[model samples]
Target chain A: MNQDWTVIDGLQYSAWSREIFEQMHEGGLTCVHVTIAYHENTRETLTRIGEWNQRFESMPELIRPVYEPSDIALAKAEGRIGIIFGAQNCSPIEDEIRLVEVMRRLGLMIMQLTYNNQSLLACGCYEDEDSGLTRFGKQVIKEMNRVGMVIDMSHSAERSTLEAIDYSERPVIVSHANPSHFHPALRNKSNKVIDAIAANEGILGFSLYPFHLKNGPKCTLDDFCDMVVWTAERMGIDRIGLGSDLCQSQPTTVLEWMRNGRWSKTMDYGEGSSSNSGWPDSLSWFGDNRDFPGIADALSKRGFSDGELSQIMGGNWVSLLNRAATPASPFLQHP
Target chain B: MNQDWTVIDGLQYSAWSREIFEQMHEGGLTCVHVTIAYHENTRETLTRIGEWNQRFESMPELIRPVYEPSDIALAKAEGRIGIIFGAQNCSPIEDEIRLVEVMRRLGLMIMQLTYNNQSLLACGCYEDEDSGLTRFGKQVIKEMNRVGMVIDMSHSAERSTLEAIDYSERPVIVSHANPSHFHPALRNKSNKVIDAIAANEGILGFSLYPFHLKNGPKCTLDDFCDMVVWTAERMGIDRIGLGSDLCQSQPTTVLEWMRNGRWSKTMDYGEGSSSNSGWPDSLSWFGDNRDFPGIADALSKRGFSDGELSQIMGGNWVSLLNRAATPASPFLQHP
Candidate 1:
């Protein structure tokens, strides 16, 4: 990996601690979009934000909050990692549509309309049918655009993902998902969905989550880099970045909550068989915050130029964020 | 009108006051299912219940809490109207399935799965397509059945309603909706839905809301009684009772909240024209809680025998409540 290049993981929900924050700084990660909510409601989300606030106060030299795209550059200059808050589900806003602005004001920069089940906003990937964006969902997308929150469709259904890209005035993103053509996990995006996002000038963050990789935990870096190159050919190198959907050091119960939440009384072994409900073993080459170099080295061996590698490393994500994290977009202002 | 009839209104969400409580006693309404939530989350719902607790304490002579079906008889014996708390939407439980039992413990006896939009439990009548019960919805139905909380599908879509009836081990209730065959309103049920509820031995509350009547606000007592006769032909007299979704003395903004509820920034002229967005004029035959005698007289004049008229007025509801309001059912015990 080129040490001069800026790196941003589009999404991560690692078990944050002083050690992890130190590792993030050591790995030269300039920015990371950290998930703050999966199934949390507004009050629970507020509590989580309060916890993050304490972390920021205690470790100012290691991490700082990123409210705007320029803050990522500031973090890189100051030798600290920028922490951008996002939600994997819109449950943080509950049923109130106006809370989109409220969430944005609280620095929630990206929000997925649904997680692993049907939400009031849009259909999730696990739903039996993809009814696409709902009336409430359309309004939410507009408000999110107005308030500069990126519309993330990583866990949304295919029809909903396509519909969101069509409905959103600004570019929508798959903050942490891989191509279904590479690995047919339910969470992976179909080619149609990927093409829609890419054509709309959105970003695709190639996931390193085992289930989303071509051969689960045993996937080789060669296969992974090949998949990325194939995707980049269709989606453009300037649109691809690393998301690494890493869930390091989390308990099996956390996975259960991620899949089931309070929505189900019975177990929902999402993306895994019933007997293999725990988290999959990590790929040998990439396991934690300090593995960006392994991916960069592999991409270089695939005959990518340094400029192209820089674009995939973090330059593309920073450019997309610059365009997306504006409080008032021309499309929304003039539409 | 039979004064001795044990009248139990299946649902009502009026602006409660001393005046309304006085009218309930004046009209000999032995029990009433008062809606406690439209879009309130659990904590908000708890606050509403706390307010009701204060009302019960302050107005002990006029009203009493009814946690069990036998409490209705107890209230009648004490000459006070029994107040049975119900939720117009399942928002009170939010996304937590175990909160079903928590709500039941809080004396929430009846709960509609959806109000006027898609909820986690089921789709509302206003949605474009009814995809029926979700994965969470099936578990919610089972939990509601286990805890003896009556599943009310008054504002739910047809397919979702029918699926709830099919999925529930206990009989479900259409707590406040009429037959579409009578009025052709979108919120009203079709013959298929009515028959399903009837076949399952569930209760159907004939709504006195203007839009549900055959001719809106101008509907005559004769027209209303005739519609009742028509509905009784399909669903036996034993299954029908009054559920006047009366919003007496409430301001237009309250109606707006009921319809929109922060779900949309735009106005939703639910079941009425844009010009008639406010509360409709009360039916001439049934203006307030003191007008139960007028409906009973109209039913008598429509040629129902005294025994049949007694069953229509409230006897059927009380009997249904007796069967429906237990802590646990045998089906759940065995299942």
Candidate 2:
């Protein structure tokens, strides 16, 4: 195995234009999870999946949608970069119960239940309360399981998230979350949830979302390295991986949407008027100073062995996804 | 009191479109939730919202977004219909926690945490085991609380939803759900969840999701009314309301999304996915068809008073939203 692994970003919202893809390639991003919608650009908010797909047909090699659980592996085996067209928001599925099948066919593997506020499935960490999953949400979970979609509760509400962890037949993933146990906030997972997911055969993607870091924008590779180390001790190397919510190309209407609960129609911000939500100042730039590329260097600097670093980068996510795809997943229960 | 009470559908995503909305207006639908995302037509969604708002904006006397919790009252007082913009999916919020407040400020209220699958905050009910809420999901809830956004856990995972109910400082809402006791499925709420939400001063908007009903398309308003009655008896009048996901203008695409886990990457239909997730096959339409609108007439016909009708129609949701909007709600334990 190559000591210098070609890493896959667990989650990202950077523009998928050819130029940006090129930048990602330059940055050694072998795979990337592209976010499709938030509240700002919901399925009803936009009108062009067909158009988007047609565009993808133009660049089959550079970027395309992944449907099969094996597609990621196929891409890797073929020595090509992989792209997972994921929805940061569930708005695209709209009200259809069966759309999960269509999405899985379309190659959407990881999914976050609630972006910021409440949805049909569950509450957002940004929701007024951490009420667990809703009645309809439970049905949704079953469907995802039936289709082998990895359940991601990264941006979900605490109540709903813990509920999801317990509810999933397989171990659930946090795809992109920090540990509040490390950096206290609504965006990070608790130590209890982290360990619980691990015990259940789920994976946790350590995110470089600066907001959850103990040191905000001023944070350095050292701080990031420390996070990986902290998580390693808690969740072990096998259940950890990379999930970078890299929102490169700011000033794109997306940020405004993101700033305004683009993920859901819920945020903790008051209901008065439009204003900037407080974020960690001096954070790493997605295309420029990502600070941690796939977390390989950071983990190594933190003294992780090559074996551990491999798992933190992508192996863990792949293993979890593959397990979820297995036929026996249906019988999985909390261990 | 004009016994011909004006009515508005809370949340629905049927084969909606220009023709459907017209049917709704002709059918005495003062206003409808008009799901924008379920159909995969965001542009058309805005077109519908704009058209509806334009048609009724000036007729603010006839149609308007239920801005304030009391806006429903205002709509009722003015002999107008009310439209509440709620997302079956929090896809719009994307990943920004602050956007929840932004969406609320934009007059978007009643956001769900996830759509049919897992999202950032919590897991959907369709999930296999049902982990509650994620840590980030917890933050999303707190933010939604500070901003006075109502938590709707209709589609959330059971554990996450319960956690949200327990964590919320404000009353939450299961905008549309059936009781599992009446019919077991991820679409229906359990006795424990139903009772807990109410005990916390929340409300359950009994849905006419059609799929959630005990009967199929052959069911009538009487069956719908019975579900409402069942809900009232089990939960209490104060916590009951009309969430009748009375979708009309929704398109087949919307239906398709509902059929599959549209927003979710896979079909997360939970236990019901294989056996239909336990949602009742028989669907009842709104109005006298399902004997839904006739609920009041039937109740009155059955010797129930007007007070109860008022409570079921809009009073319950109104009160719950009001409590949620309260800066110092008596129900809140955290704040």
Candidate 3:
């Protein structure tokens, strides 16, 4: 593996600390999109952003905010990891379409239309029926496009994902999910959804989370690389990248909060059943930010050319951000 | 006196009930701009709006929501009182400019830039050093203009009110503040603020709260009418109307919440001193919504023409709403 190669993780919601920042540097990560909100409303999201602001202030040598696609290159040049803010649910906007521009201006570059239940915008994957894009959902997609905020559908239901691809003028990304062909997890995407994303010039970020991988925590690095190669064949190499969905250093309680937010009073196991209602054991091959080079080595050993390996690792994500994150309207530019 | 006068109160924060709704009808009020939020954040403001939704559902015969200026006329024609929502503080939006449009779309017709203290947007009257408009306040002024939410500067500091009037494209309003020329209360507007509002084609909704009136609760009806006549002389008659600032049937605790909403540890007297901390005694001439007719009668007895009396009663407010509440952008119109 090349030492100077740029690596990017599409999603992470870690119990972040200086140790994690050092590990990201050790892994040769140029950029990482981090979840700042799960089910937070607008003010709570602002507080989360304030926390990130403090993090950037305290660790200027380790990480900086990624306000645009160019910021990733800047971070790479500065030898620091660029942090892109994203929300895993529409709760941050709180049923307001106009908040899309506001959040984008505040440096929130990506937002999911739903989590794992019926949201005001769309139905989530765990719901009984998929209602597709709602009235406000369609409006918000338009606003997000105008404001240069990428629409993410990682936790959305199948119909909503397809409808989002159809409705969005800009590319829509599933920031963290694997192909259901690899592992039939509820959070994984179907071939139809993956194909639609590819058709719309969107990217599918392959997740390394144990629950979404074949054989769970016991899945081999070779099997993961093989799945990636298969996905690249179906949807062009430019349409696939690493997401990882690494929830590093997070306790089981964080997993429970992610699954149950404020919507459920009783316990909701989500991907885990009653017997398995906690964070899964970390994969031995790819555990934390320090393990990216191992995955790169595995992909290279599987006969992927250096260029193909670079695209899979980070170049495709940079390209996706450039293609989708530029503001469509000059009015959206801050004065 | 005509039986079908189109009466309007610029501001009220009553313990709203079906009985109060009936009193509005009995007073021949076509519309009232009611305070829906004071120091409430976005979620709490939404709950307040939801409560109003329930009220509308329960009392369809007595009151209805006024979405546009035309709705006031409709209410008058249908013999129902129209409710126009306003927020006395910037807390409802909570540092997000996009919420100005969202709150407007959710039937919030007006918003004060601040409420008796320095806010994220601007400085309130009670703040010793008025910083005027902050960076967020300038952006919010533009957003409020685009969305047609009337910028109310009644409780804002002098410089902030002047700056808001200058900045807003549409007519600004002091929805509930007496001129300091009448009585020098901390919440009252100065002549410069009043004149700026009038110069910008705005209207000043003269407050009838006892603390804002000369001689407090002992202020005579003739004296109140004389102040109105004097103010109409300083600013044009077209730029003056009644705001009442009536807070009927509310407990003293509600006043405390308004004065020090989670912002202070100790009690803040606001307009009231420590001795008279509770709500000032209701004025004899204007006790509740039912006393609006008495005010009109007093103005009529002061030798004002019937046309001028009609304008002061409600016609000016309807005109002001039509001038300021129409969305500047066609995109802001709901589909």
Candidate 4:
């Protein structure tokens, strides 16, 4: 593994702690886009941010907040993990387009238009019918573009994702999802979606979450690397990076909260059936943040050059952030 | 009556309708600060704003939104009542300091730190302990001042109200509360609070709500005018205006929602007792927006000069808004 490589994970929703921060350091993770909100509203999202604020205050040596692309370099220089805030759902903004700017100012860098259901903005992958973008959704996309919040369509329906990519002036993102050509999972993106993303110069972060993988918990390092290579060949290496979708140290209850939120009255198994409700076992090679070096080694063995490996690891993500996360308006830059 | 005088109601929470809007026209109202949130969170508050948006669209001829003091002048020129959005509680902003600016940008011109109990920002009158201002409250105040959102302490505790007046760079307001000397209701402000407001160049908008009146619904026009005269002598006429806490066509359920919200499992009658757990009867001389002319007539009968009448009726509120509601920072103006 190249020590100089800027290793960035495009998405993670870990039960964050000092141990995990130390693990990130061990993995030489420069920056990690962390989910601060799943179904949390503005106030609840603020509480989550407050919790992260406390973590940053307590563990300043291990981690710092990444407000802009340059912060990743600063974090790498400081030997600390830079955390970029993201929302898995648009719940944090609720129905207000103005909150896109507010959340951006408060350091929310990425937001998915929908999770796994029909949202105010767009239809999710799990919905029966795909409503590409509501009137509010179009307004929100414009606002998100103006404020430089990355529009993530990982959990959104295919039509919505395509519409978003087409509608957004800035490049969109699938912060954490693999290719459906490899896995055939509902959460994974189709070739068309990936090509659209590539055409729009958007990034597609391959998900390592068992449910989004080809062989679930038993997925081999070679197979995952092969999938990455296939995606790179299809979407171009510059438009790809790692988004492990790691849920390190989180309990089953937290998983339930992620899948169900307050929207469901009864159980919603999500990607799992009743018999497989709990989180799947971690893959042998990439169990946690500490396993990133192993992934780099696997990619190297799979014939990726040092330059290509560097881009796959985090360099691509850094470039994407530089392009997609800078505020469009000068006035928004100050606040 | 001086028809040219800009007649502004400092606050109103009527069950707004086209009928009520027509009543406002009849009252010669230039502008009205309407409460859009009591206990609604950020999302729910946005829904309320959405409802008002629909109203604005439907009744463009009757009313227009007042984003700034100048908007009021435009509304008056257009022969329309300017609806200035306000929140009776800090629930809309929740715990985020940044939302103060966001809400302001969305046309929320005023926010009370507390409704009638302890909030995240300050202590309400109903609370046993009056924590003047929480750490978040101070930050919110600064943000509100910077974004040009008026700080209203109409339902706050004595210490909190005084502290807010002292802490805010811009003039604070008690948008709809009578002086405790005139009416000993817990909802009314104390002489200390009123004097502090006057000292800080803040305005006190006398409430027409029966609970804040001398003899409830039986309170005569003369008695109300005398109380106004007395308050003017003490606090200066420039610092007084009408808030007319009129509940026009709202049901008892709406009143209950206002008093109890979701905070209380058991009923909290607020200003009313258990026996009187509903809106107080409307005052004879000032029942609704259409009755403003009678109150002005009563004030005139009480030997108030035409200049004093104009100031008391609405001129003072317009001046107070000009002083308090202009954004402190230039960057916030565009957003």
Best-matching candidate per lDDT: 4
User: Which ranges of candidate 2 are over 4 A from the true structure?
Assistant: A1-6, A40-48, A51-55, A259-294, A325-335, B1-335
- Encode model 3's per-residue lDDT on B1-335: one tens digit a residue: 46666789999999999999989877878899999999888877766876775576567788888877778887888777899989999898886666676567567889998998999999999989987899999999998887788999988999888888888889999998888888988888888888898899999998888999899999888888888998899889999999999999999989999999999999999999899899999888888888888888888988889899899998899999999987876434321
Off by over 4 Å in 1: A329-335, B1-335
Residue-by-residue lDDT tens digits, candidate 3, A233-262:
999988999899999989888998899998
* TM-score ranking, high to low: 4, 3, 1, 2
Model 2 C-alpha lDDT per residue in residues A161-186, reported as the tens digit of each score:
88888887876888788888778877
Q: DockQ of all candidates, in order? A: 0.01, 0.02, 0.04, 0.06
Pairs in clash, predicted candidate 3 = none
Docking class of 4: incorrect
CA deviation > 4 Å runs, candidate 3: B1-114, B117-335
Against the true structure, whose TM-score is highest?
Answer: 4
Candidates 1 and 4 compared by TM-score, better number: 4
Fraction of native Cα contacts reproduced by each candidate: 0.00, 0.02, 0.02, 0.04
On DockQ, the leading prediction is 4
Measured with C-alpha atoms, the lDDT of residue A48 in candidate 4 is 82
DockQ score for candidate 1: 0.01
Question: Candidate 1 chain A: worst 10 consecutive residues by lDDT?
Answer: A326-335
